[model samples]
Target: MRIAIAGAGLAGLSTAWLLDPLHHTVLFEPQERLGGHSHTVTAEVDGHETPIDLGAQHISPTAFPALANLLDAVGLTQDLIPVPLSTTLQVHDAATGRPEVLLAGPHTADPGWPRTPVLGAAAGSLTALVTRAAEWETRDVSWERSLDELIEPLEVPRDHKDRLLYPLLASFVGCDIAEAREMSARAAMAFVLRVPPASPDTAPLWHNLKNGLGSLTTALAADLHHGEIHPGRGVDHVRRGRDGLDIIDTRGHHHHVDRLVLAIPPGEAARLLEPLAGTSAVCAALGTFDYVDVTVTAHTDPTYLPADRRHWSTNTITVHNGWSETTTWYGPINGAQAFKSWTTHRPQPPREPLADATFRQLRLTPAAIRARDVVGQAQGDGGVHFAGHYLQDIDSQESALLSAIATTQRIAPDSPRLTDMLTRAPHASDPPEKG
Candidate 1:
């Protein structure tokens, strides 16, 4: 059977890798290169050329075993290094105009580390909320009900609740916390608590690619046969028939295949497959999932950051915009600070204004942050399948790998070699060709 898989990001490549050989497979990507949001930028540093990641700077050990396994399979595991999480927060006082280094630590006892003192303040309320959220039983009730039940009862400080918790929740849902359902937050809190701090010497518990994250995705793409990949092609439509599928690209080219898999974003899938029945709700839900705009400013010089100061900030930070606010994070990787933010409101034209020198200030404002959720599904029709990092539950390579494994299972049953080798995935019968 000939199969066409759209998008050459990790999910697309993984699906192609898993299904090929057993059946003919061709994967398309609109970008000239693979690895959608996981590409790297090269910079000259200290006389030699070095690369920096503007996307996904860190990986947690707790939630990334599947990602790690994929890296190991592609022979890129050695590129990983344990990064200590050194973070210092300088909270600004609006009225007093003073910056207080509220909390600093790679260690509980490090000099200037205000672990307990800061926690004793209103920050203590955060630990309580986080603790309670994580400890709660997870079941069906919609994420919306869970959040109101959890947060409303907490006696947290008003400013902290507004400035800190709400923003953090926004980042989690990629939408306003009020718009986000509570089930998602509950699931997120559980994931955060599972990973304990790594060590006293190392930064908080996170890992980075010694080279760059692109290594893992690129290596996966490289391992596939050249004939298997078709880059720079955006799939515009999918035609379902009794036999199988006809995937149409943006250029009006159609490729017939016995199986079709969509490895693109959920929103993209929703748009392309809207004609199919049952997909409308998934599409509607997908439209609700927001994505944050990320402007990764790479400071050319590491010296710009004070040496005495710790480079890590909160894994997430919330800042006030003119009326509302957004969330962001900072990480020093490959000798540069990466500032990632997502905004509450979508810009008028959905433009990357950061690419323009005149609109550079937008990158600093809280409103520049983008919505971050990517929803994908098999709800549209039985013939088409959806998968990606966003669809896999979280934004990590492991989730991408899992999505690939799951999508492959849905699209091609009896093709067990890939899953047996890379993932212990469950088997599913490919639906009978739509009649």
Candidate 2:
């Protein structure tokens, strides 16, 4: 079978890698490199170079079993460590040169709880919401409801929900407050449930892939002997022909393939299939899904974090211009120290930007979840296939790998490697809902 996949992200690369043994596959990636979100930039830190990932940085092997197994199968096992869950919310008083600690999460830098009435109330409400969410999540029927609807029953104060909780949820989706409010109730539950039990006492064994995702993508691309990767070539559009599908590249070159797999986002897929007849069903389903821009910048800027050094944590969320943006303490290099910021959420951009890239993430709204089901139902229709994390059962790297395996099985069910990976290999045990 001849397959052409658009977008060279994890999903696309995994698909091609799985089918390389028996099938001919071609990948169309616009960038000069192979990995999409699995990008890495090597920087000299304290006279030693360390690879800093700007996108799709970490994955917990325990939670993402399928991804772990796949990496093992490819002979790429290196580093694993517990996920750091330290998070803080605070703002700096520029004139005073101090930070007013607003609120904190588990492993937050300062364990002392807030005292302000509103902050105290919000802390209490967070506990209530977590308790309330845990109760309803097991019902299974709760997922059908919107987050706003679920919150309505809680009677959470407008101030508490807006000023505190919503931004936290928005950060999870890499979106703004308005987008977060529309997320599914399950989306919020997923975040709270994934919270690790009281720190060092009873911690969950979720490990981060410390070697960086670039190595993973590189290994996958290197293993593809039967596939050709076009680095600078991007699929402009696809049109259904009498024989097969015609893929028009950005360079005005057309390539015909027996099957076309759209590993890109649903929004991009919908736009690509817009010209085709009898695709409205899929396009309409795709339309229900939306994406928000998340720009990540690698910098050594300390101004992005709170002014006070005590406020620095693994993840420091600064609310500036009524938007919640995160600046991560990436490294401890002397001059090569890296503190990456998600600049899209902030109106004030980080200074001395080292490297910047923008990515689009699927906003998990109730409508999008419903649309996920619809898209799942329409897979393998009209010689076109869908492959991505969003189309999988869970939105994670494990899901992305499973999606690739499942899509390949549909495309080449007889492929022995695909069959082995599905039947004999370890798959992702359901991930604990973590924000």
Candidate 3:
């Protein structure tokens, strides 16, 4: 089968990776770089080149083993580093214009978390939320429930809900705090339920790529032996012919293929399919995706962290107004104050910052579940298939890889390579969100 994949992100690359040795494939990406969210920027710090990832940096091996299996296949599993993503928070007072130090991160071994009244309530409430999520894992009530619905009954401080929980969930969904509160309970808590939050009482549940997550994407591109990957050029649109499909590139060039996989975001995919024939269902599914604009900046700015150094955790969140900004510090990695900061509303990139990038991140909701159902029905419709994180039960690099596997399984069930991959990978059929 001749397959044409659009977008050279994780899903597109992984799809081509699986089908290439068994079939001919071509991938088209609009950008010059290959990875989409798995971007890593290299910076010169004291004559040493350090890799900084601005997006999709954390993973859970036990919760999402398919991606780990993919890493093993690419020979990059050795680069995986177990890192704790503990968080510390600071909230601004609107009337007094003062910042209050909230719960110090558990990573600090701060024994005072249980002593503070607000922190104590928050801790017990958070444990309740996690327990509720676990129940949802065994129950069916999460689909109709929103995170706000769950948080309202906890009766914790408004600070915990607005500043900490909202920001964390927003970053995960790539939405604003408002949308984060409104997102489905399942989307918000599935992550917390499967991947344990950073805590002094428990083991670390997440892993970071030592060389940066870009290593995963770069390895996928480099390992592709039977496919043509076109970067700097992309498929602008597609048309259906009597025999197959016509893939029109941004440069007005045309190529023919038997099948097409859209690995781009929802908005991009919907635009490309506008000119295609018999795609009403696919278009409906893609249209259900909602995205928000966000800027990610990487730098050595100490100001991004909390005022007191002892309270610093892997993540430092500052709450101003009704919104929150997050600083992801990698100081423990190389013993420096290197950080990545992102927010829906916050400071612009610093002048001459190490790296700055903007993105339209997916905001998952109950509608996404419906969208996925629609796309699932139209998987092989008119030789058009969809694969990406947004289409999964939860949004993450692991989900993106799972999307590729699910799409490829539909594309070619008898390929020897696919058979071998599934056989070698444990829980290969289980979705990542299910843990």
TM-score of each: 0.75, 0.86, 0.91
Candidate 1, which segments miss by more than 4 Å at Cα? 96-99, 105-119, 137-148, 169-183, 188-191, 198-203, 277-282, 301-318, 322-382, 421-435
Candidate 2 structure lDDT? 0.72
lDDT of 3 by residue, 308-393 (tens): 67667777777776566778887655544578888457644544468888877776777777778887887778888999998777
Model 1: lowest-lDDT 10 consecutive positions: 356-365
Ranking by TM-score: 3, 2, 1
> Judged by lDDT against the true structure, how good is candidate 3?
0.76
lDDT of 1 by residue, 1-435 (tens): 787888877788878877766778878888787777676656555455565555555675345666655665666656666554444434445677444444343432435433332333544766677667756744433333345566667787765665555555544434454443233544445444555555534345556776777887677766665337767788878877668888888778888877677777766767887887666656775555445443444333222122333433434232323112222232333333333333334232212212111001101111111122223434225667677665534456667778888777766666654666455332121112111
Give the number of the best model, judged by lDDT.
3
For the record, the alpha-carbon RMSD of candidate 1 to the native fold, in angstroms, is 8.8
Off by over 4 Å in 3: 108-119, 157-159, 197-203, 347-352, 425-435
2 against 3, candidate with superior TM-score: 3
Model 3, residue 85: C-alpha shift (Å): 1.2
177-267: candidate 2 lDDT, tens digit per residue: 7667787877656745654455532223344455567888888988988999999998898988777899999999989999999988888
lDDT score at residue 134, model 1, on the 0-100 scale: 58
Lowest-lDDT window of 10 residues in candidate 3?
426-435
Residue 119, model 3: Cα distance from true site in angstroms: 4.1
